[model samples]
Target: MSEKINVGDKAPDFELIKPDGSTFRLQNQLKETNVVLYFYPKDNTPGCTKQACEFRDQYEVFKEHEAEVVGISADSSDSHDEFERSHRLPFVLLSDTGNKVRNLFGVPRKFGIIPGRVTYVIDKDGIVRYIFNSMTKPLEHVKNALEVLKNIEKK
Candidate 1:
């Protein structure tokens, strides 16, 4: 794993298959609005479910601000589909089956886990404005991202 990106750093671009079977290029898909890219260890687990549901609960607000949420993991698209269905998620769940995006973002991968809980908020310009790593109380992660986006809205 490389160094974790800092604020204002350019976010790495990658292509992942969308749930609808379309290929999604990170930069291209995010050209119109802010992008909330979060990496988790896996889907269908307790911590991961809590974090994803928190985002789902706040998803409408994120959409209202012209932002889209994407959850990534080494899990297959099938697993993601199951998670989204079971949780009624309203956003895209991307598959990083090869761990390419995980490595590109320098998400910590240790302890036999695919990736640690890391969230990055990328603005329309493809710059990372915030990154949060914590599974406990994951709502704080979404709150921080919204704060940044709200501040940007003020600008």
Candidate 2:
């Protein structure tokens, strides 16, 4: 496992496949707006779904703060497409096949099995400002991210 990414660290740039099969590069996104990069375990799962829906519900708020939400998981592009469509998620969902990005960020695995749930609030400058990691309280990820973005906006 790589070193765990921490607040104040520059977020590592990476490319992943979006639901539409287009490329998503983190560095390119940072040039436009702040990013709420969330790593979840799976698609269609209960906790993951609720977390995603909460993000969808607050997506406009994020935009108001000049942040863009992006979700990543080991699921495939087709699964991401279905999840986004079914949940009406306004943000992009990226397919992190083989959990490469997950490991890159050193996101933990629960019980040495389940993939961890983590949210990284990254500023437009590509600096990570906050990180929330919780396997049980999925919805808190959304709340925490919004709080961080609000704080970032105040600065």
By TM-score, the best candidate is 2
Off by over 4 Å in 2: none
Instruction: State the lDDT of candidate 2 residue by residue for 1-155, as single tens digits.
Output: 88999999999999987877688999999999999999999999999999999999988999999999999989889999989999899999998888889999999999999989999999989999999999899999989999998899888
Model 1 pairs in collision:
none
Predictions in order: lDDT: 0.86, 0.93
The candidate 2 region of ten consecutive residues with least summed lDDT is: 15-24
Candidate 1 lDDT over 59-130, as tens digits, reads 999988889998998888889999999999999999988888888888886575646888999989898989
Candidate 1 off by > 4 Å: 110-114
Error of 2 at 153 (Å): 1.3
TM-score for all models, in order of appearance? 0.93, 0.97
Q: Give the TM-score comparing model 2 with the true structure, all chains together.
A: 0.97
